[model samples]
Target: MSGVDAFPGKGKVAHCDKEKFDLKKELARVTRERDILKKALGYFAKQKE
Candidate 1:
């Protein structure tokens, strides 16, 4: 009925799903790195004080 259905049997859906998963993984890694940097900054600030 829709454009997606028109291309049935193609791996378009699978590709999108994979892309979404990759983006989520990247976001999680970046978030973890940010948290670590924040903690390091806090520690240095305390040392300076």
Candidate 2:
């Protein structure tokens, strides 16, 4: 049993592998973006008051 097999019909083998290869980088980038977005939202909220 492998990661791809664990979930069926999600994608082709190459596509799945591509995502897995970049999963860590993608995760870090997304996490950073989320934090930046939260801070931006907080700033806007404060400014509205």
Across residues 1-49, which tens digit of lDDT does each residue of candidate 2 receive? 9986887874567877788879978999999999999999999999999
Q: How far in Å is the alpha carbon of 25 misplaced in model 1?
A: 0.3
TM-score for each model: 0.72, 0.58
User: Which of the numbered candidates is closest to the native, going by highest lDDT?
Assistant: 1
- How much does each candidate deviate from the true structure in C-alpha RMSD? 4.0, 7.9
Clashes of each: 0, 0
Candidate 1 segments whose C-alpha is farther than 4 A from its true place: 1-13
In model 2, where do residues sit more than 4 Å from their true spots? 1-21
> lDDT by residue for model 1 over 1-49, one digit each (tens)?
9987887775556878889999999999999999999999999999999
Model 1, residue 4: C-alpha shift (Å):
20
**Worst 10 contiguous positions by lDDT, candidate 1:** 6-15
